[model samples]
Target chain A: MSVETRTDVPPGTAAPAEARRMLRTLARGTATPDRLRRVGAVLVVGCVVFALVSLFDGLARSGDVRDAGQRIAVVRADAAELYRSLADSDAMATSGYVAGGIEPADVRARYDADIASAADRIVHAAGLLPADDPAAEHIKTISQQLPVYNGLIETARVYNRQGLPLGQSYLDSGSKLMRSTILPAVDKLRMLENEALSRAYGEGIAFPFIVLVLGIAVLAGLVDVTLREQRRTNRTLNLGLAGAAVAMVLALLWWSVALLVGAAQISQASTHRTAATALDDARIQVLQARSNESLVLVARGGGSADSEFTKLLEKVLGPNDNGGLLADAQQAGVQVESIRSAAIGWREAHRKVREADDNGNFPEAVKLAVGPDPTGSGATFERLDAALGLALDTQRKAFDDNAGAASAALAGLMAGPTVLALIAAGAVIGGVARRVGEYR
Target chain B: MNTVNARRPFVYLCIAGVLALGSAVITGLTPPPAPPSTATQEAPPPAPAAGCEQQKVDSLRPEGPLPPPGQMPPGSTMDTILKRDRLIAGVDQGKYRLGFRNPTNGELEGSDIDVVKMIAQAIFGDPNKVQYVVLNIADRAQAAADGRVDVVVNSFTVTCERQKLVEFSTAYVAAAQKILVPTASGVTDVKQLAGQRVCTSRGSTTEVVLRKPEYNLDVVTYPNLPDCVLDLQRGRVAAVSSDDIILAGLAAQDPQTRVVGGALDEARYAVGMNKSQPDLVRFVNAVLEKGRDDGSLLASNQKWMGQQLQVVPRPAEAAYRD
Candidate 1:
């Protein structure tokens, strides 16, 4: 049984001849015990291979989860913050313009804050992206054009102080550049970051196909050896065989549990990420509406700015108040009930501002648009912004926590399987070696 | 961070605007370029047509005494506007001295705004009861024709081409198209600007004159001449061509730029109305007649345009062709 195949070594190979000599000496024993050593060798190799595959697979999944949680999340945050701050700066600048040459101190401070935040986000986003990443180019473009936009805005302010209409023209130029160039760049960067995030997420919780197959093979091989031992010795219990079988079952069970828990956590993180994205989009729309609202008065009803303001508001709140980005966010499980109401308030205030301006109540329009009043468009928009900001923060925290737990689910997954596999291999060797010694 | 100097954005905006408007003014404290040469505007022949009996400066005659405020004649345009509560006047907010919105108070000020008020006062007796619709140079006639506004008064020049679209009022202010050039350009006359790029507001009469093959000038039109001033400062064009009043506003904004050359063509500033509203035209003309008689029109002009234009003359006498 040990020498089941014909001796087929090449004629002039000393290594093969030496291997054969050793094989004949080992094969001189009875068939049953010689076969036990052969079966054990095959089982040990199977267990060791399964352990190696599990270790590598576990490490890969853990690495992907970590990357998603830290590096990808930070870059994604930078992209989203860039968008928020840029839109905020435009809205504040236009709204503050309605306050006239010498803006209110608080309005000025808010505008300054928006600009600083935008600049900071740009620097952070640029630093985070790899040099060769496509998003880096968009960041570069945004950084370069940001100053040009600021220069134009400053020129507009100067013109406004001097009571010149050229100030509005310069302001329009600045706004145009922001709309056409800088904002779009941020959009592209965000899109790229989102793709990277999705990729990391997919890898972090992917099914362990190769590891599972190897694990199953090891279990079946161990079962075959146990059956053979039982038949040869007429004893159902071989403690060594029983121990190896327990270790094999435990390894597979732990692997299954870790994979299931990690996948569940990743799915939860994805849901929160989706809801947060909707809130981000809705917030940007609100900021854009606020910008156009004041700019209509700034341009004094020229161009399509007034209509644009209306359209932006409608997109955020929906034309019939039944569906829009806010509604969509609500459907996605975000708490946008407060945002919707605040947006409606802002819309009402914006309507009054337009009415007052159109009806030649210029001072009243400016007051309503950029208010010290509690119910003005400015204040209403602020409330809505704060609400959206809070919602976004909650969603981000949920995503981060779930992602952290996903990586933690994979903790010890690699070492536990490898250690169990090593123990299983030792038991197989010991069990078969004792059987072979009895035959000798 | 931008790592900018300690200067605040407000100061930066002011400096940048000053540089753009008068790039050389702050650099060397260069004296403001010489005030534009005063030349009386020349009126061109009306656009020829097969059988049109329209005149550039002719309008309906004022009939009887003025209608009292809030008690306009029934079935009249003034009555329609009165019912609407606020008089809608189409004016440009970018015309600095004529109809600009004051950045200080967000109030629409300037001489053209005063004209709108004059009409508002006639209808409502409250000069502030006006809904200002900011129209571009191209939209002026369309605004009146479509009844989007009861009157258009943003330095609106009378022309036979526009006559086909909307009714006109007697000339309230006389202006002319002129050349505006950079001080350092050393180019003064319209002839010198021939073959060089010049900017005019889109749908402005200056575009027509500058586009003439004989002038051989490259004409570029913008939404407003004040916008053209941006182009001029950036050296995008050799000069800007528009009504003297508009050029004056641009010049005031940017002292480094100066209005030059004699009047290229004449323009008569008048209120525009829906062609179907002859009564409205007559009513507005009567208001202008009163302003001219009381010297208030000239007074408002002096207040707004006197500094930029260097001379504020009395408005022309009314002409009726009804």
Candidate 2:
């Protein structure tokens, strides 16, 4: 038996030069015991390590997404609360003042409570916020300017009680401060939080394709080596290599399925949660509109009602039916259709009041404005506000349900894969070592 | 010894794992407490005592119709005023169209100050002969108590509490409390202002009603009426509550506001005098009687408040308390 191998080819054999060179390379191929074992070890270890890295990287990013989503939800809620508080305080302040010169006890208490809540929420938001976040500046502005506005209001109160002509001007200044500075700052903070939330969701479902490629490569290598070993030894199977190959395929399948589930969850969250959040913006606009309505009456034709209030109403309800914030919310499938109609009605009532005032029916205008009549602007505004609030609640619930599920789906996934990866690596080493022992 | 050494790595690994788990659990169970914040708020000042009642009193019995100007009753307060060469009268310069100085021209012209001029005319026969002393709401009572001015006629609202502090002449002008709000303000009555900011002048009867627990209003008081009107115009306070006539003056100044709702309280304006000066009180009452009877009161009302008020001229009926 002359060791029928290419490396042992006779020197006189009439072989082409290319054929000889190819045979020499084949003789030095990885089929040799040491090379096969070494190559198999590398493939198995490489696959496990690559999968582990990909798993951990994906896991870290998913964790970040989950944390950011939760934080964004909290911060966004606080921001909205602050915005509502400021707006409600403004409306209540105006209503109270219109009702009387000195604020009624109930109205004053409500205003004070609103201010306190706004301050507290700002503090909480500031704490959760990044050091360099733009929202931090807005929060600072609210904090700093809130006290100033309150002081202006108190000054107005004192002056109003004294029956001084200057008190009305002070009250106007206070309202201006709220509209121009504080509310806008709060809106900016809300927008920033919203952006951060979207970024986190985008990062969470980012797929890691490298792990799949590495897994496939490792499996192919194991299959090829096993088939080669079977042919050379005339054996039907190598149990150890078969085991390693099976483990690699299983890991690949698990990673692929897990990624698909995560992606599906992320997609659902993006569509539903983001849309719901957009509705929140519209809901806030409704609140702002309500405040403006009250202040319009408070202004007593001081120009704010005609200019600023008109602009705000158009912004909230969409001008000429061409899609404002509420329209956008409707297109997004948020439950704001009724609110939209109510807002229109409120605006119409307001216009009627203005016309009455212009026509010199001052008493009639006042009655239309704040009267308890079902068709009055006050009642219509309350309805519109309530409808929008309900819509916001519904959207918030959907966001919490969907995003929360997505985030929860990722929990324990990281830890499970980490432990599995270590076991897989150990198995690859053990299985390959068993095969190498056959040569001994 | 070899067996024991072989198990050492496993034992050490187990120990490390347990320690790690134990420490994590311990740390998780005991979080660091948050630091206390240093922010605090100052306590508000205590509120003033309440329960002052609005009171009505009878006019003193005048000797008769007033004598001609410059011919005063000898050994009386009128003689003392004649000797002084000018009627020393206390007036408010801040009241709009009532006692306020005109910003356009340096002249004191208003309903209350007009009454002061009438008194001066009665004493020295010249309306410009009055030496004017400006008095605030608080100063009105003290001025009368200390005899700083001949009489305080600056929208003085009579109350049982203030009567204890200073004597008042017979009620000259009976003003009533009412609400003044912007045209757009839906508040039509004081009852509607239950939770509203209701501004009134300090030491005014409107303040008493606004501060009552039943009304539950945010009663903001200022030293003078102009400050309250300023607050209303600025949208700082909701509505102003004071004497209807005073509010009408405010409404007249600013077309944006109107006096709405009925009277919350009655304010009977009287000339404030020293408790010891009964003759002065009687003499001022006589002047008021002449003014009320001779249409001068109606004339002053027409001059300053006619456009703003629903004027129905009538004499203030005289009553004798003694």
Candidate 3:
């Protein structure tokens, strides 16, 4: 009655102006029942969306974390065992051949066991990986070649027992096949597994930015609604709006705590597990290289054998001009200087053995090549491998401790987020519905 | 009354559902991981040429009586050997009993080694003064041609191509190329081995014969005879074919294996010397003649080959070209 009439100077426009003023009033009063209900519906839906998004995100990330942890602990361990078994088999075969007369029964048994272990590991590891995985192809190659290598070794053994020098050639063929084909494939499989692990680990700790922004936006909108209510109704607080704001804030806080804890754990695991794997790789390479060296002498391939062992040694340790696995370990924070020094000693001892053999002092050469004397090249190689073994043990322990903690930290995180998300969504719906009720 | 309009909220719910579904698909349908480096399998090396069928191997005839020990004629290769106080003979240390070192004694003792020692004794009267230089099957002739050794006695098969490079002594042992197979491989002869892999030493007569157009057999060549035996054991090859003497040695080693097929070619074993060393060739021929007259040659063959070979004392009849 008042505002439109107070404008009393315009009599003919009174009807239209009154209508206009009513429209303005309706527009200004956002607490009207229809508008309140609409706003409450939107807020409730927003909370539901946010809850679902956060829950699924947490669950997916936790899955990645769990997968990576399991692979590092189990799959990588199987691969490492395969590597060791192949190298050990090669060494035993060479030593048995070099034993001269009849191969000792224990040495023969050990060779067979090592071969069996390698085959078992290949089959087990292949079963775990998908068909399309690159490691699977490598596994198939090793599986196919293993029997051929074993057959060659058996032939060498038979010929050796017969005192035929052709046995050495057979042994050479077996060793060459192992060094050039099967072991390299295993090495490649191990590398692919490590790469997969790192990828999964990387994905596990990524932050959920969209979830955080949406949560904050919802909280701001709730606060604005509460303040507007206070201004219009002279109320100190709207319990519904206040409850919604608290729920949004609590949801965000819980998300933050879980993310921070998971991030720390993943970070620790990544650092220690990657370093440990690198050290193990280096150790395995050293073992294979040492086997190559022994086999060259066992095969007595002469100049060609010498050069072949040199190439293999360079691949494992380093060339005199550059660095290889030892260099890689050093870069990864492992103390491998002792291993390097021991390898150098091995090379020197091998040179002396070569010199004796070339000088036609074959007995002296055999004594220097495989003798149990501390100064023999074989002894030096043993010392080198032992040092690498120690290094590997240290790294392995560190990896186990850190990765275990990482897995434990992610424990229950997936389900915890889902539960929190559900409670937050329920609370938001309830709070917004109460405001709609007040409007009614 | 306020209208209960649910259209806007419904639209928002639809958008949320679509976004959620999109993300799930995105996460679930990731492309497969790439394979690691693909290893290239090792390719086999090039094989030697297969000689023509008409090619004949002509060896020297070792005729004449050996002079008394240390009583060589003046200006002869034997005199040269006597002055040097050592006979450098190229030998094989990988052939089973034909030319292999004794494992227990670490001494080079084989039929070939025995023949060379007798020659050394005829010149110096001491077998210990001989120096053995190990040579492979293909390099034996080259070693003699290059004068890197005085003689190559490592199972040299007298062939036309080899005779062109070096002079051959009379064939000391007659070996025929034969097939060795697993006991129950269902392959009794070379005819049954068509389209199947047969292993032999590289650059040997057996590999050459197997590669001929008529056989159409797949031939796998190895660096040494033992490797062929290994391939046969693994069933990678259906059979291993080489000189009968070599097959006999291999069969003796593996009880499950036997010499199955008949002779494929006649491989004559002879010692090789450089073409420029005529006096040395003549002296070696003389030594062979004297060894055949005495019982020492038969003894040498028996001592190493008694188990696998019933070696007949049929010294190669000598014929001179000049």
Which prediction has the highest DockQ against the true structure?
3
What does candidate 3's lDDT look like per residue over A279-328, in tens digits? 67666656666576565545443444577556656765777623777777
| Candidate that scores best on TM-score | 1
Q: For every candidate, how close is chain A to the native chain A in TM-score?
A: 0.88, 0.83, 0.82
Better of 2 and 3 by lDDT: 3
- Ranking of all candidate structures by their DockQ, best first: 3, 1, 2
Report every candidate's CA lDDT.
0.80, 0.70, 0.72
Tens digits of per-residue lDDT for model 1, A1-440: 32433355555775776777656644453366555665666677777876777788778777878878777777787888888888888877777777876677787787778788888988887777789987888889999999888888888888888877788788777888898789988887887788888877786666666666667767766775576567656776777767888898999898889878988988888888888887888888888888888777776663345888778778877889868877777776887778888888888888888777766677788888887789888888889899999999998999999988988988768699989988998998888787768867
Off by over 4 Å in 3: A1-31, A104-159, A162-181, A207-268, A271-274, B1-33, B36-94, B101-109, B115-152, B163-171, B181-197, B214-216, B231-239, B255-263, B272-295, B311-322
Give the interface RMSD of each candidate. 30.6, 16.7, 5.6
Question: Would candidate 3 be rated incorrect, acceptable, medium or high by CAPRI criteria?
Answer: incorrect
lDDT of 1 by residue, B1-322 (tens): 2221112322333343344335334434846346346467866533422334665667788877688888999999899888888888889888788888777876788889999999999999989888788887888899899877889998888888788999888988898888889999998898887788998887777888887788889878777777787778778999999878888888888889888999889888889899998888889988888898888999998998888766785697787766
Chain B fold agreement for model 1, TM-score = 0.82
Model 2 spans with C-alpha error above 4 angstroms:
A1-33, A104-106, A130-134, A302-307, A320-322, B1-322
